[model samples]
Target: MTAMGKVRGYNAGAMLLHWAIALAIILQIAGGFAMMHTQIIPDALRFTTFQWHKTIGLLVLALTLARIAWRLLNPPPAHAPMSRVESGLAHLVHFLFYLLMLAVPLAGWLVVSVSPTAIPTLLAMSPDLPWPHLPLPAAWKGEGVSDLAGTMHAVLAYSTLGLLVLHVAGAIKHSAIDREPSFSRMMPLGRLPRQSTAFLAVPLAAGLAVAFFGGGLAAGRLGPESTSLAVNAAPGESAPAATGASAWTIDKTASSIRYEVAFSGNPIGGTLGRWDAAIAFDPAKPTEGSAKVTVDAASIDVEDAFVKSNVPGPDGFDVAAHPTVTLSVDRFEAAANGFVGHGTMNVKDKIVPLYLPFIFTESDGRAHVTASVVLDRLVLGLGLQNDSTAQWLGKDVTVKLDLFATRAGAASPQS
Candidate 1:
């Protein structure tokens, strides 16, 4: 090799992109591992971490592409003198690193795309990245595709971990042990000391250890059996009678149904503003009483206009296609607290059995009722069907109802 072949330092743009991508990769590695332990982290925080990880992965992919183009347009600084074997090994590692840089995130993207959950990838909690909703082949549908992609992603991540260690060790050895300017070639802000490069390995090693072991621990703790809720009823059950005893009328202004879910590590709740209920009940004749409710799915107001508008979108309530959600309860039995009702709720043309526990009280010829129920949103086709999305958004949703009613011939409470 000629004396002039020795590289002095990397260009400004190259250095910046290198360090930025490195930092992002480290964060992504750590976050990805931590996110797997949803049982350990708070729900809202876990979901937020996932969004951030996804966003960073995409950014890394873009940066890697740009770096590749830049390298082609402007070749990297020449290497310091080395034996032919050393040179060949270095080039091989570099090539492998680049391949992994591209493949890891691409695998992750595929995992998300083929996911049955159909969860949207949002950037910074606002603008959503456009992801293709491609149909999987019959052989690759259901859990098969997601599992394969996920395995690929995990394997690629560990490969990156190994590559990262070798790359860092090589850089440190070249600069510190060999007393060469090899590491300096990629630094824009002049050459760092050999000791500093050696020290860098400490944190890198610590990070890799955390990511590998933490991910393994999380995976073990949160196995397939640990994450899923017990599904008691199948979808699409027949509707039951609403009332069996005395007929009653719901006071629209005095009744409301609300729902709560976790988003970004916070509890976000909203009311179904447009709904109607029919009640027929008598404390003396509990078996003869029944109740029914109809809700305008589009009328969900989460307080945030943006979220409210999207709640009825294709991935959400799909209000345009299925405008109404209905619930019917034909069986009512006395309970320790108050009363229990076995019912069925139909949303988006999908029906699931519902169990309602409620408290009822009457005074001044008017009855006041407060009831609550928990339902699996996926079973009712209210959201995406993938396991990851279910973990992020929570599978079970709690619905609470408050109502005041009067018998057909009874005087109104206000009157």
Candidate 2:
């Protein structure tokens, strides 16, 4: 074989970093896509994998920058003459590869930066870059910045994947057909025999380790806050009745009903706002009360763009046709905990029954009610793949409600 190109061989440090970053990027891709396809994977593990992906990605960028600086300091030998087409393709491919190397992570960074919700920094977990949770003037949460960033991230990810596949094909073509050490010379370690064990063992172990640690960090460190949510109400002066006749008169000023949804491993969750509801209750007979609420199907919001897009959007509700989601009380029974209520939720064009276990308290003539309910998104035809059930649209959507009631004489609370 011709003497190895003087510029060809990568040093040990550069080679190690390259392999490590490549392995990490590959595993992250697999893990990420796998998580998207399979809901069975614990969310904590998914998060952990993402954290590691970010961490390693930052490391890759740092090393690549250093390599660029080093290349500038010590120039390499010139390439041999080649055909015009070969030269053009070589240059184009190399340029595209470099762009992917930088673009994928930067795109991801932008997506995270514009995230509408705050990402908690856990103890012992240091961020490689500045957290972008804080809102800038006139451009805060609910703005379209994150959506744009997210689209860019997805675009770059696919671009990178295409480039990666081409890179592998080019390497194999050069190594075998050209009978040159074009690919081998750059190997930090010397070329391996066909079907070498090192090729199998090293990459696999490293990927598993990274995935495990990444998943663990996300699950352990970045988990949701463990605190009960409470909404304070304006005080009242009169005494509450004890004849099991207390009824809740919801605030009329409230144009929206707000609550946050949290799951064991999900960093992203549902946020509901501006539910259109009408309360019908007998002021004198508090025990007899009912509520008719219609939530805008398009009003659902999520912190993560990926999760938001994955969630069935307006099509799930067809808010254009039926802009409102209605809920009507079916049954209410007093229990030691508070009140157990059953209601029929009308979403999209379908109605499903939901049960809510809640606590109702009457203080100084005012009634406060708080409850939680879990319902299937499938009944609403959410996450349907050709009308078949899929777990990607989790079967259960947990809803939390905290409504403050007042006498009819008071103005409705601004929702």
Best by TM-score: 1
Q: Whose lDDT is greatest here?
A: 1
Model 1 lDDT per residue over 266-287, tens place: 5678888777776778877777
Query: What is the clash tally of candidate 2?
Result: 11
At residue 161, candidate 1 shows an lDDT of: 87
lDDT: worst 10-residue window of model 1: 225-234
- The local distance difference test score of model 1 is 0.67
Which segments of model 1 are wrong by more than 4 Å? 1-6, 33-44, 125-141, 191-254, 261-274, 281-289, 296-325, 330-368, 374-396, 404-415
lDDT of each: 0.67, 0.53
Please provide, for model 2 over 252-312, each residue's C-alpha lDDT reduced to its tens digit, 9 standing for 90 to 100: 3542344333333553466654454455444344246666665655565555433343233
